[model samples]
Target: MPASGQTAERNSHLKAVGFLIGGISSFQIGATVAKGLFPLFGPTGMVGLRVGLAALILLAIWRPTRSGITVQSLKLLLPYGASMAVMNFCFYVALTRLPLGIVVALEFTGPLTLALAGSRRWLDLCWALFVVLGLYLLLRPETMAAGTMHSFDLFGVAAALLSGCGWIVYILTGTRIGRMFDAGHATTLGMTTAGVLLLPWLIPVIPTAIMHPWQGGMAISVAVLSSAVPYILDMLAMRRLSPRDLGILLSMEPMLGAISGLILLHEALSVARWIGVLCIVIASAGNVLTRQKAIAH
Candidate 1:
């Protein structure tokens, strides 16, 4: 390639990276904001608020028509949205009890595993070991002063893992949906469907949250920063980058969550716990890089 072409390509890649980083930062900040509202709406209620408002925003922006709607489309869209609903619920549930960074680190294992699946590379084994070490570090009992012991809530840990499973389902179904429909239309409908699915549980929560206009504004903010902006930026970045690059970029979320929590929520992690998060980050990034390498060979 010529010098000018190389420079343009480098600039393009840099722009996409910036988009991905901004999306992740927005998402972490949104998570911190949601955490602050737990006293008002609670976890499930907050998830309802976030998804409901996000659905509306997405619908407004995409303006997706029902011209091509069919039962066949609903088939994939339903499961995709269901996965998102479950994932969001579980994630919030876990977040209520665990540190934001820990919840994110656990939830990230799903994509790490998904990326590592069907790989035969030796380096992939090392990534798996990194995951194991990370998990151990995250879960192991750390002793505190004054005869205290520090540990994560088992139920919260379980919820985070379950959230990971939901993410796996979301990725699998989302890929299929993207292939079958317009990405914007599919995302708009998927988010809306997720909101509808959550309504069964959020019936009371939604009405209660709506009564206070102030709470409604907060919910809208969460929706815009967390769901709408991140999703839009992700779509844009994904178009310009490969899946592996996307995966690598996403591995930074645990750190982002940790930093956001410390700054906005005043949540802090122990030194070992920080290392545990780093291990997971490395594993997540390594898994993606190895997958790319395997594909090349």
Candidate 2:
């Protein structure tokens, strides 16, 4: 590539990076706001309300056509939407039991694993250890007063871990969908599919949302911030960033979530979790900084 082309490519990567950062910040803020609403909506109900409203909002903005409504699209959209639905449901379920930051940190392992899989480099191996250490600190928190270790909510931990698996599917299928359709349209349809998948749960949610207009307003705020904005930004970013790059960049979310939880929700992290997140953040950064050599292949 010529100097001008290289400059343009670099510019594109920078813009994509900005989009991802914005998406992460918006998502954490939205998660904090949604956490406040969980008391009224419950975790499952919140997932329904969020996906439903986000689908509706995105549909209104980006109208879809019937041209690409082939079996092929359905095959991709189904898994994409299903994983998204599962990811959000499990995430909120874990959020109900865990701090927002902790849930995010644990859930991040899915993408991190996907990104870092099959690496042969010594640096990658070292970075992988940092990730493992972070997870260890997360899973094995400080000891209690009685000399026994503090045990986390097992269900929440499992849910968070499962959500990470769903995240892997969501990222892979979502990127494919972005390539096949307009990113905005793909996001709209994908959210709609997720909403449909969770339609049963929306039964109770719809009534409560109607009865409490204030809660409905808050749900809408969440829909815009969490699903609508972030999904679009993420899909756009995926167009430019390889999955490895995406994973490395997204690894920052745990740290960002911790900050958001602290400042907005007044949730304080344990010293162990803070150190864990710091290690993961360091690992994530190392991968990105050393990515240039990997690109040599």
Per-candidate total of colliding backbone pairs: 0, 0
Winning model by TM-score: 1
1-297 per-residue lDDT for model 1 (tens digits): 999999998999888999999999989989988988888889988998899889989888889887888888789888899999989999999998999989999999887888788878889889989888989988998888877887889999999999999999999999888887888998889999999999866677777776888987887899899998898888778878888898888899988888888888888898888898999999988878877887799
Cα TM-score per model: 0.94, 0.88
Model 2, residue 151: C-alpha shift (Å): 1.9
Which residue pairs collide in model 1, if any?
Answer: none
Candidate 2 clash pair list: none
Candidate 1 least-lDDT 10 residues: 200-209
Compared with the true structure, what per-residue lDDT tens digits does model 2 show for residues 92-134?
9999888888889888878777867888889989889999999
Off by over 4 Å in 1: none
lDDT scores for all predictions?
A: 0.88, 0.88
* Candidate 2 lowest-lDDT run of ten: 288-297
